[model samples]
Target: MTCFLIPTVFQAGSLSLIMGCTPNASHSPVFLLRGFSGASVSSSLLFLLFLAVYLMTVVGNMTLVLLISRDPRLHTPMYYLLRGLSVIDMGLSTVILPQLLAHLVSNSPAISASRCLAQFFFFYAFGVTDTLVVSVMAVDRYVAICDPLHYHSVMSRQVCARLLAMSWSVSVVHTMLHVGLLLPLNWAGDAEGNVNLPHFFCDHRPLLRASCSDIHSNELAIFMEGGFLMLGPCTLIVLSYVRIGATIARLPSAAGRRRAVSTCGSHLTMVGFFYGTIIWVYFQPPSQNSQDQDMVAAVMYTAITPLANPLVYSLRNKDVKRALRRLIGCGAVDS
Candidate 1:
């Protein structure tokens, strides 16, 4: 991705200031993304893998969303949250993978600074949205099992809409604040006008490393603010499951316990897979973080999760399978 680090004359505030109001003799209008450009691994091989993943992601999420929308039986709180999750998955993958796939093949792939910044904004926004939806899904499960009699009243249509609105609002505010923090960095660090991002996408971590000004402040924001965004929902999921476990344990029979766990099994698997990749990329200290591994693991959520959502959340669901069968007029076929 290419970022124009050409020194802009200071105007005290706004975009000029955000672009690092400074004087530079030379104008560098492009940032060359060196994403796997120097690696010995076969670029074609990697391209095919990512392309397949992206295709599956697009097809799978689209199918899930359509299946949910067309099926009257899926008009419930859980499926509502699931539709949101699928949409975010599509957004997240779109923001990262297409550009990454391009860079993997080209000798000197580049992106405009504005596009890069936009990518950065959506990446975090969708990521935050994903976590919030996952947490909410956990709560939906908790209510469904622990208080089945009151589930509908508790997770009513209005309540689910409000939850979705709150999640997007929180995510947008969080993304805007951080993107603002990153804007002033283009001209801060380098005397040579070199402000290229090292990662495949305009990942904030690499952007922070590229900036030499107020590094501590940026880390603090990521750890304190971003951590709250990440961990707070996680804490909710953990507590919800703890209660769910307790409720399942009190069941009278082994069959009952199995049934209860089965209800949560798919959601729990998704939570683990999603958060496992997240922690792999985010939890480590910057000094010890490996970008290579981070790039690979990012595929899990960006592409793999979306690709798997149909199977995990919908295809395996008997109701959804029945709906799919009916959609295609194959009622006699086994799901």
Candidate 2:
């Protein structure tokens, strides 16, 4: 293996030399991304479709945030958490989609190592925020349904703010831990020397696959830490829902039960969609055939989910629909 030392500057104002194992090859500080190579669709069409979806995701999430903020009726704990979820969805899509759009248009789809690291950091942070926010929403729902009398006292404005703060803090720390583990590893390739990543985004698994470094410890840490980040919230959500189900079942009137179920229906749908895709992407065993599946799954959680969330909440939620109508009517009157 011929080693070439290439000096590069990270965003942190530090200069480091990266070692490449390819013989007589040009030393490029950029990492080439293999984005949706197996797609039968043309890149131009794909780009346009995704661009539309991204626009919709941003606009929809922003509208949801505004609706929650403007409407006094939605000033409850549930809507507060939903607004946070919208923020996270918007952030997650923004971080991933612009880079993806650039890659789709460019003939050479590559990113600098520093840029890749930054993307990875923001992507994971937003994703963890999404998960934690959803989990918090579940708990909020549980408190509202299971302990209705004390819900206000338990999830007060101050308490809700603190919970949101805690979720963001945990997300930042979780992303930092992953990025810290990834930073020290070398990206030298194998004997045949392929360094291009298979996925569009700078995900941990694909980056690890491209590296020639010993990732045993890294993998272990990912399994433990990543599992906690993924499963812990999911378990909480499931438990909360189960308790909610029991409470709903115990309700005296069928109308009351229906109301309770409807209250959580939108959130349940989102959690199912988000975690279902996420679980398939991360937990499934890696295989040659599964590459396309993984990419599709990643797209679902990153792009499709964000776009769908506002639609789900807005359509299923009568309060939100009424609030939207009132807001639009007020705007029209002003105009």
Candidate 3:
């Protein structure tokens, strides 16, 4: 076994260097990302396709936000939470997609260590925001459906504001904790001071894998702390749905029960797909995980889910459809 360890330690803002096992790893300031196997051959096609996706994600989410904001009928707690979700979706896509587009067209996939960690920070931050906002939406839905008489009082403006504030602040601090843990570890790179990150984006797991220092504690933190953060919201979502199901079950009208089931089914399907991909990406054993597999799963949440959210939560909504139709009618009458 070959080992290299040195006691020399250096610290800079959000970075620390401590030489450890692996060739010249501590000296590296940049990491080469392995974007895709065929990037060179079909980069243009992939870029065009993804650019279209990014554009649609932006336009769709923005339209939903505007629609909800403008329509007085859509000013309830659910729509408010949905608007928050759209804004966060746009943010999540913006943080990941544009950087990814630049890397796709560039000759070298080199990303500076600082830039790489920055991506890591924003990606997880927005992801946690997504989770929290969805959980808040679930709470809104629970109150509206399960206890409609007092829904307004229960989920008032002040309460909603606080929930949203907690969601954003907690998400930022959660991501900061993860990034701070990673800051002290030195990266492993080759003769050219380049660590080859397997995934396109700077996800935390890949960055941790590229580290030269021992990551036992980091892994422990991820599994224990990260798991709690993710799992807690997921449990909230599930319980909300379970209560919704029970409430619907008591509906004396057969048709009413079916209609409720249809609506909730669609919602659960979309949420399930969104969160299932997250679980697949994050909770797997290291030995069983591969970069390619992670990349595929990543596309579902990072790309597909954001794009689909407007359709799932907004376009299908009868209130939104009525609002859109009314706007179109107004435009037609004006012309």
Candidate 4:
């Protein structure tokens, strides 16, 4: 959101000096409150924090991918869904982190028009894919619970692959629609001045606000696409989980039922955190105090969620840890 015009200060021997190109020409520049007041802190501190988060997120997701790939025993519907989630986590982190880190340190952070559009495309696409993955996971659990007899056949590898493919394909279509719509819009500045946006990245809402023309079509498209991607899947997940809970409760042995529910507790917790934060941020009406609040929630889904994923899935999963140990050539059995 912070529109800083970066100037090619000077290029020396394999080094360059860059300066924040303030408005020197006739046009007056608009200053947007890009993000939280990290302007108060030293740039080094911000960079370090972002770096640490990025490293942890990447490592966690990579570990999950590695574990799934190495251990053939983990070739199941659940782990497949988990690996898909890992892919999205890695992709989403890559989309946001590097630019954010650069912006944190650089006095004048500037991204090219093409890069900005590309960022939005990937970010939204991955977000939609992640939502679908969570829904698939919910259905996986439902199959394991409500239809145990045909769980394997019902949620076979082929079906899972097709579902994963659908998620990615739908997300691509969704992102293309928005990006194509943006291409025709006159994002260029007028004779008066450059635009002011109040977010860190080129988020759709802020970018649309900066546009000179009406964005009703864009807004409607966003609402329709977002609603279809989120609400439909979310409803399915909730319903599947509800039936799963009922099926668990009807079990004869209390301990068995408890253990069965425990298998999904972590995933259910994750889903709750994901959908709760997202709904609170997007579905509700905006308020004057919503900017900072929304940023914190955004950090949950963007930064913290991916970082916490491996922890959540691993800590609560005996099978994953067992598989990891085996993959590492540690003892196959845990004491």
Best by lDDT: 2
Deviation (Å) of 292 in candidate 1: 2.5
Winning candidate number (TM-score) = 2
Task: For residues 206-251, write the lDDT of model 3, one tens digit per residue.
Answer: 6765677876667666666766777778789989999998999899
Model 2 residue 121 CA deviation in Å: 0.2
Each prediction's Cα lDDT score? Answer: 0.72, 0.77, 0.73, 0.70
Cα lDDT tens digits for candidate 1, 1-335: 00001001011111211233355512223455665666687999989988988888888888878878877787888888888888888888889889989888787677766787888899888877887888888999999999999999999988988999999899899889888877665433345444566567777655655544444555556656776677678889999999999999999999999888888888898887666665555455646535664465555666777677666876457767777778779533233
TM-score of 2: 0.87
Indicate the worst ten consecutive residues by lDDT in candidate 4: 1-10
Tens-digit lDDT track of model 4 for 224-259: 665565567877987998899889988999898988
Worst 10 residues of 3 by lDDT: 1-10
Once model 2 is optimally superposed onto the true structure by TM-score, how far is the C-alpha of residue 306 displaced, in angstroms?
Answer: 0.9
- For candidate 1, give the lDDT: 0.72
Off by over 4 Å in 2: 1-28, 189-194, 279-288, 332-335
lDDT of 4 at 113: 61
Off by over 4 Å in 1: 1-29, 187-194, 280-289, 330-335
Q: What's the true lDDT of residue 325 in model 2?
A: 94
- TM-score per model over all chains: 0.84, 0.87, 0.86, 0.84
